[model samples]
Target: MTMFRTLYGMLALCTLLLAPRTLPAQAAESLRTAEGTQRALPRAPRLPRTAFLENRTLVAAQLSPAGDAVAYLREKKDSRGLWLLPAGGGNARMLVGSTQADQLMWSRDGRWLFLRASRVLSIVGVDGRTGVRVPLGGTERRRVMKLDTSQPAAVLLGERVRAGTGERWRIVRMDARGQRTLLREDAHWIHDVALDAQGRIVALARFEGDHDALYRVRPDGTLREVLRLRPMDRLDLLGMQADGSLLMAGNPGGNFRRVMRLDANDRLQTLHQDPRGEADLDEVVIDPRTQQPLAASYRSTVAATYGIGDAQAVVADIARKLPDRDIGLQAGSGPYARWLVSERAPTLRDPRWYLYDPRNGNLRRILDDPGITANAPKEATLAPKIAIDYTASDGMRVHGFLLLPPGVDPARAPLVAQVHGGPINHFRAGYDGIAQFLANRGYVVFQSNFRGSTGHGRSYTFASNGDYGNGRVQQDIVEGVRWLLAQGIGDADRVGIVGHSFGGYSTLLGLTFQPELFKVGVAGAPPADLGWSMRWLVEAGDQGDLPDRSLRHTLQALSLDATDRATYTRLHAQSPLVNAGKLQRPLVIIAGGADRTVAIREVIHYTATLKALGRPLTLLVEPGGAHSPVDPIPREAYIFAMETMLQRHLGSPAPEPPGQRLRAYLRENLRLAGPEFAEFSSHQRRNPLLTDNSDAQE
Candidate 1:
């Protein structure tokens, strides 16, 4: 998974799905949810509730340019501190107190760390005594193009400058010695940049609305268009190869992205395309020193970057040594050099950093970030996530994960198929908070990367062809659940579905279309009608969350065309709101009143219609909650309400009675409690903060 999706789960989903699996009950102040649950399934859970919600170590390790010392960041006293770990295993010392560091890179001579916090870039001395702030020039934002660590101690930057009548990007070079030089400028918005070994700009990718183009910078100061992609296609320039050709990964005229080399003559040469032709060129790790790619892999957690040139052999060796492990490349001084690597071993369950010495072909475990490792449940208490794939009804292969309930038999335990947010994003075999929490709750958890999910390739992501409502996308999820059931992985009569955003919509679709298959559902911020949602996305203009026209292009590329009458009708006919009366199974929808993604008005309308039709539906409308409801009270309510809903319908663990804070908030926000929320509504209303008081408002 990408960092953006990881952050979305943390901030937006809050601690709702990320309910920590605690140790005993040191901090189990449950929403009457993850923390304070007091019930047993076949038996009490081995790992407490808070274990899954534990925070990760907010630290990163970087191999210094000399490759003899490792510079790492650690969270200390609410601020970040820079520390140096000796490569030869000696005492690590704090170099300085760095507050709120967003991005950082070591200068060539290892004398300073150029750290960027927001718009200000400061070069802090490694000696802990000197600090120099690099002044910036631009309209409002000055983004770092590349941390040019080659020579002359300079950094490449892109400044959005005001042109004659519009805005353009002015690429400039800023040195540690307090000097700046204008390299070149571009008319379109620059998204990707690459530099040659000598620190000269080789090629860059720019975007104008949905159209993207990659240009090669000539020595005479002119840009020659090398490759251009249509709105429906994708393209990315990785780096400059040692032979001066630009290494790129894109789906120029095809559905799947492949690794290629664009020479000085603009001729394209295929490097590696998935030999099986089933997966995309997922992620590329570039060498900072040479700006050339080290490796590429299809899975988000790549076992290794084993598809480049010289760096391929080194990574392939590492892969051979650590087979079945997610060996992701972290940092290295130059190409074919010592690397700071991150390995996600099954035993660890979480990624651990290591210093890999290519000379000796050995990996030495280094100091970890320690946030999750220090607080996670013991290995015996937790079960490993098993990666599995099965063929769908259409004969196309589908991949997913299964996290069986600790100590619960697959044939006897309840099943909860948890869906991911982006219909395009896929689940990797690693730490998944929602699946872990649900499995800990004594339910067999299933997460499937349906047909439209990414990672497989461009064709895989767009395969559903805007059929999210009831087509292959929906069938993929249902087929996965059925496949697991046939394997005796879950109790047939006690299966439920849950998710957020698009996953939320999938949950709704599962209950409406597969009522007998899914006994209950819990949806968060679900857009009741996919057709309306797509139209609203394109017609409402840009929300400024992403680049201009990025969202529109994504919708268009996915085949969701609001202008097409037939396409809109098909999406509308399959939508849950259009067929709400078919949903006889129990469902509890937790919605954010302030959610712009799924308008609160539509949710209210759907709930009101369900109430009129006497459907078993409950709605919790959080007035202050945004799309993800990061707030503590609202997030707690989501898990608590869903837990209660499932417990009532699927015979899962019964939630503990509500606390004062939760009761007050629920009493006010439970717009329609049907049968699922009747237990929570019966909680005593004698709390002091039951009114429009501080606790209730929170």
Candidate 2:
């Protein structure tokens, strides 16, 4: 009997030992089931349209020179004002109410806030009691070039005025007593000016026709040319270092712009350069007291900063803790350093700001955009952008960003080739509203940095300078799409193209010249006839307050050759309006009624020609919209129209229409003037862009 009892006890102990191991497996199975059920359930409702369109409530937050107070611009409804808050904890107070003041800078003594209001330089007391405007002498726009807070009483100003058939640039030093001293004047445009700690002009950038001349100011107040950039090259002077050496950014020998220091002896030393040749050194962080470079930021696939010293090393460590966000040094140094870190991702509707202090080793949330945080969908997933590269037809390497919808098979997804404006500009990895919105709705978004795009070296830029509508520039985009299709990342049957300004021109070209590649096109502020647009720019030069010489120069650099009639004829041939009959796909053209950059008349004429030809096109006009729509109502409406059109053409599941409030706002703000306005109604026929392709396989 004792042996049997002992055996029973041994068996029970073995069972107990095995129970924990089996229990975890069972729990894991149960958890998996729960997650599957959750996935089957409907997702959280999407945020309202207005939630994405509202302007930022807080912006341009800066710390006081003493680091005892913080000042920021606050916008509520239609009112924008400056507000101050004590760092030690106190009630925030409005310094100035109902003012359009911006570009806030603190005085050296921390007693005044210097700002620009209505194109005039002004200053107000920190207590919000006294206000004074620096008499700039004329209404001709004046820009604050450099403010020497160390001196506390003087500022460098760039004054623009009309010269004989061109614009003349002048640099002046203005004191607190309203006394102005002219420093230099030139017929060529002055791009920027830099001042030393002693309130002396140390460096200046002058645009002289084909190249930018960078000049150094000597101790005798004489200007000497230090460097001259080629026609397509870019150069920017940051500031004078503690040793009086000039810190500059440009690509002198390499393909990328790197931070370099130029000494008085004309010797150039490289301070920082990114390993990726595509990155451009953007901004240099300087120590206010020592006037030295602490860190510098460069933008490649995304913005990244590198520390030049131990003090900045701590800041870089803190930045690494917060992945996928851009960190900026707003003000202060050492233990009292304050940083403005932005959380910008495609999944986020708006950016969130944070303030960090190295002394306390604490990162505190300062501002959360109410529009995004309060209204974002609970189940929305953030999409990831992948950096990609492809070879063009001529074997030129091209780079681009690709965003695919989460939880969807990219092979079966419809693709939108979203081109950026500024055929001169290139797209960076960040929170692009349009790309995110489209990806959220199940469309893959691809942004290509074609040959003409910046950040790829001067040769690449010059390659696209004269090749606007046709040539290798357009072929680069075509090859990109074909490469994606060949990789099975895009559904060839359902593809669309969309762009703004110069991008709009590319969209028109794609639809007219390569109709088989796209099923739909959406263009905003596109210049249809290059020749007419150039002429209009010259004619409208006299109507505006600014000079037109820059516009003429731009025309000469891009699509014009004043000496060749054949070149003009080739440019005219590239106009989509001349080949409206080839537009077999559905197209939507958006125009800003008040757009001065690309006149509304050009859009009107192009759409009128398409309408006359009975092509499948829709035109939506924003009555008082500028080149870029800023008003939330009209902007949201424009997005909604694009969404609806894409859904119909791609055969994707349509989300809920714009809420009643949004629809009412759109009706009040946007004008539906196209012949097919009825097609945009609640009950309308499927457009020609929506073709039934049941034979397409995944």
Candidate 3:
């Protein structure tokens, strides 16, 4: 009997030992099957996230003017350096491996490469024979652009700083002998400086009051304005003609950009224009081999996708000459000769090298990154477009991009009017997932290029100059939503609003001041009170109190300020946190703990106000994130939290991830006792047994 009992115990122990290992395998198998089933479920089609994910890392690509060799800045987390690769396509080798090394450039001859590391600039021989620092001879503040060995001279441009009422900039020249010469000086910045074929120092560009103008400089420090701009005209000096005329691009008379030539006689000749005129003058180049206009590339705003039509036509005409050639736009090159003029092709890393044969318009597509072509997403689940116009508070015609759901009929889509952050920024038409992601689950996304937004004229861009966190900016967003439902594309009943940074402040103001519009609200890194933000602005380099900081002084002069401190306090009371009790919809707030710009403490105070109001809200704090949660991990966390909250309020489909238990735990337990939950709860409260019944009942 004793032996039999001992055998039974041993068998029980063996079963215990085997069960744990086998259970995981069973669970993993079940998980695989469940995931497969979930994926196979009949659902709206979406492209693999690989399309956006692959290009997430942006390296500074430097290319030779001839497009034969390339160098780029590569960063793997904290580690960063320059990597060199053949322009025609080959293995990339690390030229400089130190983290601080960046700003790689090729000399005019393309025989050598230069990189800036801290205070020192290192030069590399293309043949891998010599590497040394070229001694800088100009003032400490002056910087040089290294040219080719054939030219053997570098152009030095100085920093422009406004002193008192005058602007001061120093332009200098340097040679291989490490000798410096003060070539020219200007109060305004010299925008474009290039060595002509005759080795003449030409100052073809200058920045004046938010406008660029073409200028010429004699070898002596004398400046001559070659072409003056109209109040609305912006000059982008393309390059020099072989005969010494300047090639410039800008919309001189219309809304769209057009290429034009400023001849020796100062005649502006129009080159080409698309009907939609919203074409972006990407870059311009003349063919050194042929001494003719090589090619010009432009990106169309999503609102006016008609620009792509011209691009397609131009490429089709080119393709007729070279049969079976797919073309892409080369991103970066020099003044003469573009790399690619092919239509619908992905832009090369350095877009400037794009060369189109002006004689025949034949595109040269070299250095094809097949990985991009092979993995490029072809799915049509891009951001939707709704061209709507709204009368701003000032009665200006404000055009905005209203993105609706991918598959939903326009009539059934919910609204999520997302205000872009840069009050100075504009949202162009493009394939953006954030808009599509909101839309995919069923929500109409509205992105506006409000009054402060650019791509409009300078007058429109600086309209909201001193009006940060004021009513004018907030009204633009409010009026945008009213225009949407007015168009009957959005369901006014189910509307949510969201924004980030400055946009985040607008989102909060949209809810607090105009509570009836948005049914649900989210503000990422928003500044709550204007007074605190004003103080923050002062502390964070607003320079309003300082005398020498003229830009800040100029900006301060442009803003709408209270006549007195008392009036400013009245403005503060109108803030989102001042009236948190008015929030009718669920609110979600996200803040980065390490945020330096928009203080995380401001968000915390805002959330605290909402919490005090007894309103349901979710607060997410990214640990190592900053005011800009540009990092992938934290951004994903913020996006997930936001989507989950928005889905909860607006009834949109949730993304597949974050298992049910985890989601539930976040919703139930991490509601507000974030990070400090364990410390905050007592023994009885911490015990799941005690709380389980009460939580279930509640």
Candidate 4:
């Protein structure tokens, strides 16, 4: 899920519930005559830019184990603080005075709340009266792997240590008293450690060349190889079950992942699998006390859950009663459960925390997001995404989601091919703000899950391993657009391409290699040169601080390597920087000033090259932004710039005039390197903020 999707859910819930009522009944009746002939309604009004970009008032909320109190992180203006509220619903009092603390977790006994701030792990009392920070030695990074809430004080941690040659992983156990003990050490790269009910490390997973090896730890500390996955298979440990077996999700011989149990004898027993082959078991709900699987969820077109036993079935029944929402087991155990459910279809909005007490057959709403509800459009106005499949030019079946603007003529609607970031990541059915924002502005959006995308199976994911830019992956996207145009759903002359990260790379490829296809291109933090990115990864591995072996191996899997001359040449040939002269369409490139993944230098070089070629390009540099623009300022600015660019190139209807916040962001963030920036600024100046009586012109 995108960061915006998660943050939008955390906003004030009252805004959602108190949103203005739908069009009046008298207005609706007047639209239709006495003979019941319907009249076409005016297009929905455009919401303020702040409605889509601002941080939620409430950042995060979590219910305590015993359900007596709820701890939440609240954001106001520039600062965020932690607060605790009684479960009965009253004013919340400040707990953590500092705004730096986040990722709140409660101790099993509900005595302490664990939080991380400035790379330090600290705990605060439930009463918000006392607290202590765990003393971590040196600057080496350490991560808390597992908090055995059952043990209350014991926390399993992964610490990096210098070994004979490369860096190794050591498992350390710490108590609330700040006492630390070295539990286990491994020469291999340990990814995760699982503890049994007794708080003993029973299993540890190590990353090998292509697959992960699961090792079982005996009482005497001897290691035994229990389960090893195939090249493309993956196993995620859910923890040790009550019967001393390990519950895991993996695709051993099947196309999709299934929840299964690996017994002490190494025999695997399948617990649950999605009946629809397209859906993969994404998450498993387990009982924290018993370590037993209660329910599992799969995401095919949309998310669906399967209950393991009767107790979970009852909860699932209640979840079904509330249609088009993703139900989550938040806290509490057994019959009395607290669920965090969010609207999953039509438009992704309205997330509320609910408490279900089976003893009284009562399901009461605990907390609701007011901001999301208030900003959400009515069902009739919002666009609906339909799952689509089309055969690629290479005979490969590709999947995608097509969202058409509501009440618009499909044949003439301009289209935006919005590509997702991770070329490896697959698109799921949900509320995507970027797609919705474009659709709302009178554009059809098509998000393609091309080759190498996950969720289908091993074969589909591995198919695009070596076919990065010039291969089948780009063809899949092209075919999807062609499919849309063939179906009379998109205007070929007004089509635009936009994406971030690898998707950004794809955007560049679309304009450079397939120049005739896209009228304009918007790339965000894209790796202009693949060979440079691979070399950076190789250097990081040599530094021996972070685990770069897996990254290096993945690069090799994709036939990308800086050391190999032939492979390096192939990658360079496919890079956008190498083909800057081929780009004929108008382009806008956005880069993060502080991005570590794709260095700012690469973006600067790419922009410089585009300038040298005199290509129509605009550059926006987000100061202090990361790989993806997370802050509201940069995020909104990016959207505002893209919306303006699309209107210019795609002949789409103009969105509402930019507000003060958006206008300031554009002036501050837009880089004055190219001539295109002046044109963008001029366009913004011409369209002043709209008045209530002013008619919006395209």
Candidate 5:
């Protein structure tokens, strides 16, 4: 907290702490012009850099419960608000001043739209009324448990409030009419809830410090424990089945989630597990009328939805009607029930919604958001992604998605391995802007859901336990690329890596440990040393008691123990920064100057060390950004830098030059620029540490 430490702590990172410099007017004007000097490569489709950088929600619409209208949350720049409209696309009943909300759900009665913006919950009447707003306490966390359309306009809300030293869950009911009722309050956190057809709480699953339990809500309003699981096991109360049993998803550690039935006598029966036994059962579709899981989704090589009981035929019917697109079904109210079907494809930037009457097999397209479609790249100009799987070096099977540029020969395309951020997330079937942008430039994009990634069953996720920093997990990615290369999917010699956060760390590892394989790396807010980052997280990252997902416990299970000295030693030995001398490939690091997760100081120290070693590296800092820069200026600058480096190394497409504002940003915030970025900026300042004639080394 002292000024002395704040200013001088990172002073050693550079030989000189030069004052900020503004770009010359001439340099700025030059940058405002299109295209860079390196136009020797194949010309790619010209799209605005903003096309790849826009993260704003274009629009989200949900089919009304009555299946006669659609509720729209429009976020177009000029039209930023909520609106209610008819199913046939008539006039909109706009709700003024309600521009942003975190999540959206329709009220049960189809008269309102439930919106949550941080701690505040608001409901907008479809009649264009001002609506009712309810705010929670400042320091509380809430999860919307359920919104059953068969009932009234009430919601089952789980509010987590600070209790003495720990936190407790207060389950409450809030309706569109502004009525609030306390259903039940418990000491542990309520993770899931199941309600009956009449809007009554059937059961609730709570996760405590060392164990989890499912409690049945008795008729007298008391709670009875029906099922309990010890630490590391999973328990989720999906809903109440028709046979008076509690439908659930649970796993006894090891990551393999299974669907089961817990009868009134507390007898458990296995219903459905991933058929391949390698993917977790996610995306449970609940019946609005019966309040039970009708279908569930799992991801292996690709994502697939398996229906439960009578729902299997309905899902099959939808598949026959709508082929080649991922189907996301949201239940709606009607005679035979209408399904709000969202059709998603690899090239479709936005999910195309359809009103499907399962009874008569009737389907109709409903959404046409101009905010996205107006700026979205042409469908024919975009690439297509396919689910792929390959065997790794250790004989374990790995699955991922690959995006190929349209009209480009797979045998000749350059390769870019796009690693995902969460060591918990995976590359799935979707329209990814980054992958599409890369593919649009004629690079064969490979994203491997390496070991330690979720979506695949628990065993695969737990397979990388203690293997982090040891090359097993990284090998999965490398092996996948090698397999693809063998299939003539990409050029073996022309390969680069890019990612953010953990994926960023993987990018650095590829450049450092496998420099001969990967020619360049672009890391966004990378944690240079995994062990150090974990240690910092353990000490300073958590606000209160560590949650299950905090990596306090999961880190030890997935990789190394954060508090163990031996674990730190092993992790540091394999970390990129500690092995910076091994990195011979070009690297461009884009960092948030004030990143709390991966401290900016860590990035500075790593780049400084590389500079001392005379390594070819560049550092781009977004001073006002955290973790990653969401603002267009810094983001475009990053894309430009990455494209330039890749173009220079791999013969990829040339990038459009940074715009006027981005040029100024580069001149000021590009703390370190190398020869790769020489064309974009007049100021190419290499550290004195990089030259042998210079006196300063450290």
Candidate 6:
């Protein structure tokens, strides 16, 4: 028997409390209508709602040229921090000493470590020496930019604004001594900067509009435009080559991007073509481990770079020497070393890393962080991922993951539609909390990479064009539910939906627009109204509160006349609030009090409407939660509320106390058992934050 069978009593109570009330009214009106309204039997593979979130962590330690040490990041408890270990091997030391610090960069000399925190830039020495803040002059304006440091003693590209005037950025000399000297200032904004071996700078400058021109500038102020991207042609720089050439990764004349080498004489050569049907290269890092380009990391970090040269064959040949693990390309430092062919080992779940050493066709586990299974719970296991495709309403193929629960009847699991954020960002095949938590409680979670999701081609992404907050995206989600039902994997009568941010918006729309498909919904930090969000963004200025400029431009391009209120009203009609009256399902609306992205006012208004309607709506507000729940108390409280809600609605087990259950789940599933588990459990016992804020939001 599965875990859920033991909790049927809890499921019965939820069904009795939240059942649709109009059933009796319709039953008396007409026999035919009543028959049509009868709930369908639960689908097979009704996965449990409990799953584990596999946090994305950085591994595969590599030392710099000087080999003082190699560093990697360990992501646990949702806290990401850097740790340094001797390159040859020894005890690991914490680098930043705090999870808050990110973006670690090692200078060529390996003597200095640079980091960008918010808008400020600082460097730390490797010797654990005291840190010093580089002098950034001026009290009003921020630095325009920073120099590309591949070259030695790189200059600082910065702009200092006058008290009451606009500023022009000038290139300034910056050395290890922290000295500065003005170089030049111009009207154009520098899009990219790369330093050549000789200390000359190659800059990608954009004039008015989309016109980008590449220029080589010497310290003496001599400048020359080596290549120009015409208004008609699309050309962009990836980085600078050691031989003074430019590495370009954009489509000048093709569907997919191919690595192009542009010489000083303006001639172009194709180095490598991107894999078919995959996202184009965003950036490439030369592998310092092998002196060859090892990996190409994409925006989503789902994809990686591979060597097309002899190394490809060599990696395959070397794979024979290693365990039967999945070998793939990984991204990081220098040339010839471009693709760090790696083997992902699942027995460790931590995925033991193996470096692709082409010279001897050998693969070796680089650095291993063995999964500590001692503390993990026995009941909670890592969710199983299966890749599948479903056809959308428009006949477009949609790809997604079906996260199944462990040891379940596959025939009668409840379903939770887990929508991912970005609406544009696709779901990667990894462990996540929101989905796994639902699975742990006996709900089959369907994570879709619907239309408008990235990692696919630009065309597929554009399908979401003008569809922002439109019915199209919602239909994709709705169709996903239908697809699961078609597969006989989820019970339609027990389906629920939940998401955060855009995912939250999808959740709202999913409930409001297709109420019959799901019995309950949870939307966290969702934008209730798109129009209000746009206005809020415009008012936010440069605080990153608004959508990307490209998105704003696309919205206008779709003929959304901003001058006309009717246009705004028509678009606003697509919001969940406008159709809230159509919703008959229960919903949990959660929000952070200080969310700068989506104002709390909008959520308050939506919940106010639901309250006025006397609907079965539960609202969870976090006093300290921003767009994402970070504070441990609020986050745990959120998990508890969600678990209890699912238990109440889907008829799963009565939720264990938030603190006890969460501690157990974390320990059992995350392998955080024994003393560490006791420590974490005691810590939670001591902190009343989660329960303390439960009534605060209400």
Q: RMSD per prediction, one decimal? A: 9.2, 12.6, 16.2, 9.7, 11.9, 11.1
Worst 10 residues of 1 by lDDT: 7-16
Per-residue lDDT, model 2, residue 198, is 65
Candidate 2, residues 204-242: lDDT per residue as tens digits? 887766566788877786788988765555666777776
lDDT of 3 by residue, 451-508 (tens): 7665654566667654555466666777767755654557787788888877788878
- Cα lDDT computed for each candidate against the true fold: 0.69, 0.66, 0.54, 0.68, 0.70, 0.55
Clashes (candidate 3):
22
The CA lDDT at 259 in model 3 is 71
Residue ranges of candidate 5 with Cα displaced over 4 Å: 1-46, 54-57, 148-151, 160-167, 195-202, 217-226, 230-234, 241-243, 250-259, 273-278, 369-372, 542-550, 679-681, 684-698
Candidates' TM-scores?
A: 0.81, 0.84, 0.67, 0.86, 0.85, 0.74
Go through the candidates in order and give the clash count of each.
Answer: 15, 0, 22, 9, 3, 51
TM-score of 5: 0.85
Order the candidates by TM-score, highest first: 4, 5, 2, 1, 6, 3
* Residue 450, model 6, lDDT: 77
Clash pairs (backbone) in predicted model 4: 12-370, 13-368, 13-369, 13-370, 14-370, 15-370, 16-370, 16-373, 16-374
lDDT of 6 by residue, 484-603 (tens): 665456787888888888888888888787778877777888888766665564455233312112334334544332334665676588887787687777777778878887877677
Better of 3 and 6 by lDDT: 6
Candidate 4's TM-score = 0.86
Which of the two, 4 or 5, has more TM-score? 4
Better of 5 and 6 by lDDT: 5
lDDT of 4 by residue, 343-462 (tens): 345364434556555556567665454632355455455555656566665556676777766556656788899988766687776667778778778788988888788877777878
Compare the candidates by TM-score and give the number of the best one: 4
